[model samples]
Target: MYKVKVFVTLRESVIDPQGTVAKDSLHKLNYGEVSDVRIGKYIELTLEKTDRNIDEIVKEMCEKLLVNLNVEDYRFEIEEVVAQ
Candidate 1:
């Protein structure tokens, strides 16, 4: 089996309103040292062994469904795992 960790984030050119809000709130709460905050999504997926290329599969999934190509960028890490 394989464990996949997908990280999706807004492109640097895109403004992250939610992250900005969180940072502002933190500053208001006296966390003055925080310079900036960026929010992102983490996704975990488990797949059974397959003949298909794992990297290609993951990239296809991310591009087709998991991420918005226009505004968001994504990267993934794959780890081999033993099924219980």
Candidate 2:
């Protein structure tokens, strides 16, 4: 088995309205020390062992469905899971 951790975030050039709102709320709640806040998505997937390259599999998933390449960027880590 394998465990995949994916992190998806808006491109630096893209405006993050949700992050802006959250930061504004934080300031109102007396958390002025916070400078900027950015929102992103985290996804975890468990996959069965396969003959194909893990990196290729993950890249396909990200390109096809997990991430929107136009406005979002993604990074992922894959870990082998030992059977107990």
Candidate 3:
């Protein structure tokens, strides 16, 4: 089995209303220095099958299923599992 860690976040030019709300709350709590707050999702998947190009195949899956290609960007890392 291999471990896949996926991070989904908004694109740079995209406006995040959730981030703005968080920033406003922070400022109210005397944390004005925190000008930006971005909210995103992190997902971890374990692949039970492995092949020659597992990373590429898994990355494609993440792009197709885990991330929204229009407004969001995603990055993923895969770790090879070694049986103990």
Q: In model 2, what is the error at residue 64, expressed in angstroms?
A: 0.7
The lDDT for every candidate, in the order shown, is 0.97, 0.97, 0.87
* Each prediction's TM-score versus the true structure: 0.96, 0.97, 0.89
Predicted structure 2, TM vs. truth = 0.97
Question: All candidates: CA RMSD in angstroms?
Answer: 0.8, 0.5, 1.3
lDDT of 1 by residue, 7-84 (tens): 999999999999999999999999999999999999999999999999999999999999999999999999999867
lDDT tens string, model 3, 1-84? 888888899998999999999999999999979969999999998888655688788778877788888999988888878779
Please give the distance, in angstroms, between residue 68's alpha carbon in candidate 1 and its true position after superposition: 0.1
After the best TM-score superposition of candidate 1, give how far the Cα of residue 70 lies from its true spot, in angstroms: 0.1
The weakest ten consecutive residues by lDDT in model 1 span 75-84
TM-score result, candidate 3 = 0.89
